[model samples]
Target: MNVLFNTDKLTRLIANLQTFTGIRTNTFDAAGKDIQLSGGHSDFCRLINASPEGHARCEACDARAVEKCLTARNAYSYRCHAGACETVLPVFESGTPIAYLVFGQLLDDSSVKQQWENAEKELGWYQGDLAELKEAFLRLRRFSPREMAAYAEILEALAQYIQQEGIIRSAEYSDLQKLEMYLDRHYMENLSLKRISADLHMGTTKLCTLSKKLSGGRTLTWLIAQRRVNAAKSLLLKSDEPVSSVAESVGFSDYNYFTKIFKSVTGITPSAYRKTNRS
Candidate 1:
């Protein structure tokens, strides 16, 4: 398959997968760890972020794979992540799996009859109930085999593009991270685009452009506000600090503004946040 490795095309491919297959694509750097996973109908992104599934399984499975790969050496596929029922496909470049594309377990025309038969065959050997499995199978959405092949081709192109374009190792995000880390450390201080730009030896306008790109289109001020709000979450969890105190600690001088922004981002007031955590 022809692969375009530029950023614009990569973003478009990711968007298309989300639109068509209802599956999300996650890319890793040269390392096996995930950089980001998005655009999936399943909340597997959230699960992978907080749960010990993919990487943990990969570590153990990597060693055991040599024995299993006796039948297939050219390409390797295995699914043991909590049996979440989604298939994970590894995208390789020069024989190394650099990115993983996840699809399947969706509800489609053939899944019902096929899964029921398979479940019955393995029912005595497997731990999960066949009825529950059937129910879960029926609930999910499925893509046709043609759709699967199309998505696979797009992902293969994306993987090739990532390897050739150096997108994974780009220094473009470093300055943004530096500014974010600086703000994280010194948010309580007087912070503005001017002061931060001066410190980083960048112009305010350029900084603004980078800020939007790096923060997923959130302006610099919004990013700071989000940081403050996130900090308030931690304080709510770990400290008995009053709402106003937590607000001040995170750089919001005005308690009302803090409450407004915190609620806007988290859908709960700071007081409610603390109370829920406490309860």
Candidate 2:
């Protein structure tokens, strides 16, 4: 992973993955330090601080084993933890393992009996009657192998998304940035995709397509609306500006329209939001 790329981007990507696919997301460095985590799928934080016997031995063992495998792999990949439901997938950009995308947590369910023999050996446990363990494992819902494969495919898609983002950043053209900055400066003064596109020497349609792709569904108008709404939030928070004035400051000509949109996006009227959230 590039040190220049901060955790903010990775965190945001994890959030996106969770939204797009119902799977947990996490990122660990090449040396196995967790950089960002979402979905709260692991108890590593608590486990690391606890005494040996009380801590999460299974999670610790799995993380250590995954790190070892990652260290040895020539390409980005992951090995399924010898457990019933969990599998770790590594996200690679240009053959360098930058992140790990772990999914499939159906380990505790029906898989126990099906994989009982295998998991016991993998965990280095004696094959005594696992009736007690099975009882405990049955508490959580289990997924089948097919379901696990579906989750793996989702993880693979997320990896491709992160990879595409890396490729875009590496290219690092200033056209998109310039267009956004220009909009920020002049959105209140009447801006259009045609004008911004002309300034950037890009066709309007192509610019719109690229902008939508980069923004994850925000069109030019929606982006402008978001900026205006964000400005409205700041004004609502900072000074005691009237709603109408705040709307004007944020490039919203119609106070009613601004209020409607703001309420739609935030689930509360600006006045109510300011009152509740503002200091």
Candidate 3:
């Protein structure tokens, strides 16, 4: 769960983006912790967040947006509960999402009147100066649909730049840790390189590379076989199950292949290992 990045440089870049685009930008880590890089929230949002209920709703809205973006694996745009437009773009490293770039807090020019009416209805639940809130809401920067699309493109490019520049990355050790954990949990199932790669949201080649690194230069198949053999050894010593049963229980469908792999890994057949290790 360790994230590495240059905070100062990221903050500077976000700030400059905000200055140029008139749209605030922020980043959220995989765990959904916000890293506020650009300037503060817009005056309209600030007024809404001032109320306790408004703050809670805003948090929930953001969480839902982030979840949708992660599921879509692309930029997601939506109108917030308070009626401002926002977009969330996920940042990925080697097919794994590491962070998100959230930009937008403007009024869509075509929908301003409707948005204002909706915001006024929702604002009744919040204890704020209604007139001041309305004024701030009206003052929010407005964008046409085409302009919003342009900003979305800009944010998408920025996300790629962030990855290329290593503005955010999951540590190599963490990557290895996750890979090992996944293998440990599912070694007994029917496993394959494509399945594991897809489940881990990693490329097949990268999965193989990390597996080799984890197993001290062995291939990913070796790691899986090693896990299955280790489990088979435990079963052989602890239980009197038949050799075929033990192999099958540990994901070895073919008993003969299991024997081959067990000998390769443990330097003995399963039965021999059990007999020698047992009291």
TM-score of each: 0.42, 0.42, 0.62
| Deviation from native of the Cα of residue 253 in model 3, angstroms | 46
The C-alpha lDDT values of all candidates are 0.60, 0.62, 0.87
Worst 10-residue lDDT window, candidate 2: 42-51
For candidate 1, lDDT tens digit of each residue in 65-96? 33343234222333333332333445554464
Report the lDDT of model 2 for residue 241. 78
Candidate 1: misplaced stretches above 4 Å? 1-170
Global local distance difference test of model 1: 0.60
Per lDDT, what order, best first? 3, 2, 1
Off by over 4 Å in 3: 173-279
Task: Compose the digit string of candidate 3's lDDT tens values, residues 189-261.
Answer: 9999999988988898889889888989989989999899989988998899999999999999999999999
Q: Which candidate is the best by TM-score?
A: 3
What lDDT does candidate 3 reach at residue 190? 98
lDDT by residue (65-170, candidate 2, tens digit) is 5676477642223333334355666666556666565554345434456555665565444233356444544443455657667666766776677666662132
The TM-score of predicted model 2 comes to: 0.42
Best by lDDT: 3
The ten-residue window of minimal lDDT in model 3 covers 29-38
